[model samples]
Target: MSRSPSIPDRPHRDIDSDLPDDERLEALRGHYEDLVDVNDQLSEQLDDAEDRRERLREKVDRVERENETLKSSSLYIATVEDVLDDQVIVKQHGNNQEVLTDVSSRIGDRIEPGDRVAVNDSFAIQTILNTETDARAQSMEITAKPAVTYADIGGIDEQVREVREAVEQPLAEPELFDEVGIDPPSGVLLYGPPGTGKTMLAKAVANETDATFIKMAGSELVRKFIGEGSRLVRDLFEMARERQPAIIFIDEIDAIASRRTESKTSGDAEVQRTMMQLLSEMDGFEARGEVRIIAATNRFDMLDRAILRPGRFDRLIEVPEPDRDGREQILQIHTRTMNVADGVDFADLADDTDGYSGAEIESLATEAGMFAIRNDRNEVSHQDFTEALEKIEKDDSSDVISSAGYFYQ
Candidate 1:
């Protein structure tokens, strides 16, 4: 052991008694001042020593913890298979070894089957672990509701009504369905061309309802490994069940629900398995409770016939391109906040945008605003819209030509 350094003695001063009374008094005052200075120095040293002692104590405690950890046996992850009186059967994860372990009284009441736990080499339960949810599934949950509402969406009134009836009405007014002695729609499938407000409709539903919104794409469900995709699908549905009155929006669902083929490739087989799991979850033997499913697909023809059956998707709604009226409505909605000149007529703009979808109409409005900005104008004129229309047509034609060339080559 290292010896601590000794503290130096306090300073001392002796006053001579032979001096005159005033001189003696002055000398005594000086001696008293010196003692006070020494006392202050000692107190400062003691304070510094205490600080050092605290730091050393903390260091020692950390080392002790490390030493204890090193001496402890490694704990392996396990799943509780069954729980008996005071013993529980656990299956070790990596080795698939099942063993009966005694549970302490502290955690005996809490130990249950299907729970994850940590076990030692002797199969003694150390601690119970939380049920693991797929991180990918957790990320798919929409914590913040979208700002979109029914008013924000244009040209999809009928589709919106159907979605609300299928998803929203059941959650909001279940008594009506019960009184009518009819089961509400389990799922709604929206099929339409790309950029026709299919996704926006889902957003509107999410915003309108106070239920949990979990949005995911079909391509994301197709994992690279065997069983991984199916596991993720099961986990997602389980999570939705936990958060009741939840709406699951699966976009571009054709990626996994495509028609099955005779091909025996592993990749294709895995996808088929995942789709089967999704089908089971959609309209399984067990009730889906308060959960509702909404899926959208651009390639509706590619979807499997089994998935489109009555029970899975009670309503197969087609969200087609907006008509002249819808186009005009969409234009007005998109440009509601823009600075439009008095001469700019949305009806004329709608007529010009002939076969455009709602999304295209919105894009046209944005492009017109950009054109006005380019000309250093605050208000958008009819001429700006005309120019924007021409530019979009030209770009579309160029894209068509490029695609044709690529196919021909």
Candidate 2:
């Protein structure tokens, strides 16, 4: 019975036990074959994918490098197709290739085809660039050059005659001075009470002369910083030289030409320095017919005696208040276009308003016409004129006058 039990236990295959060596070897060989096939396919797929990724990366890097190059360049590239007298036409180059863009470059400057260049920053063979731009930008610069013609300004016959002889004639005929063996006057000073057409007279001279007008105030020439004012003066003269036939009009000459004080305050010293520079510039030996100066001042007595010297201001013209005849003419000039009433007498008006400057007369006429318009009247009446006089008197009592008082004066 014991022997039979042992045999029964061994009957079926021992499923829980390790396989035989031959069978184990065969199974392992089949698994190795499958692994090789899978490895080969995976390696091929990996090579293809890596090659595609590398190509994409190279493309992206190239794009980035190009973008960086474009961003870093300070130059603006453009194509030059046409060159006009004063203007040059150009197009910007951009994109992956040459493409038309809105960028432009100035003439007499250099730029590359399809290259970016700064319009303001570039090389010009003719680049002896004008340095006058900076000097001309001074805030207080007053140019003698004016836009008003002699015809444009009205009612200053005596003043105009003086200006013509002093400024306009000299500018128009440089040879006249040479022929007469007389050196041209260095400057002319216009002095008058405020609002007497002094400025207008200067404008007429500027318009008459073919000169560059450099207008400035005397006070503007003084600066807190040392040497700055002097440098500005030198630059201004240099500009006048480069651009010949220049007129320098200084408004309020008393500011720079004030009577020198013995005090040593910083402001006083600055003003003195500015005045010295102005005097030197005005009467400097190098001043020729190419440059002329005109200065205006309401306070002529406030100016230093040295500034009034012959060489500095060869002539000092007085622009006085307009007399009755002058006022009548001035009023007529300003009111020629207005719808005047039949009884409006300019002579009566002139007789009524005395000691009024040309400007005041014009203002009075304008005010009278405006009053008429505001009252819904087509014509300026004697009542309107009287009211205008009263209103002006109320505004500035000193300017208005009674008819009897005016005639008596």
The numbered model that scores best in TM-score is 1
Q: What is the C-alpha lDDT of each candidate?
A: 0.77, 0.66
Stretches of candidate 2 above 4 Å error?
1-145, 152-155, 223-228, 285-288, 397-409
The alpha-carbon deviation from the true structure for residue 93 of candidate 1, after best TM-score superposition, in angstroms, is: 15
Clashing pairs in 1: none
Score every model by TM-score: 0.65, 0.61
Query: Candidate 2's residue-wise lDDT over 249-318, tens digit each?
Result: 7788787678877787766766776778877877664434677778888777677889878888879888
Q: What is the lDDT of residue 115 in candidate 1?
A: 75
Question: Residue 318 error for model 2, in Å?
Answer: 0.9
Q: Taking the tens digit of each residue's C-alpha lDDT, what string does model 1 give over 41-114?
A: 78877887888899899999999997587448677767788999999999875445789889998878998897
lDDT, candidate 1, residue 217? 75
Q: Which has the greatest lDDT?
A: 1
Which stretches of model 1 miss by more than 4 angstroms? 1-141, 223-227, 285-288, 397-409
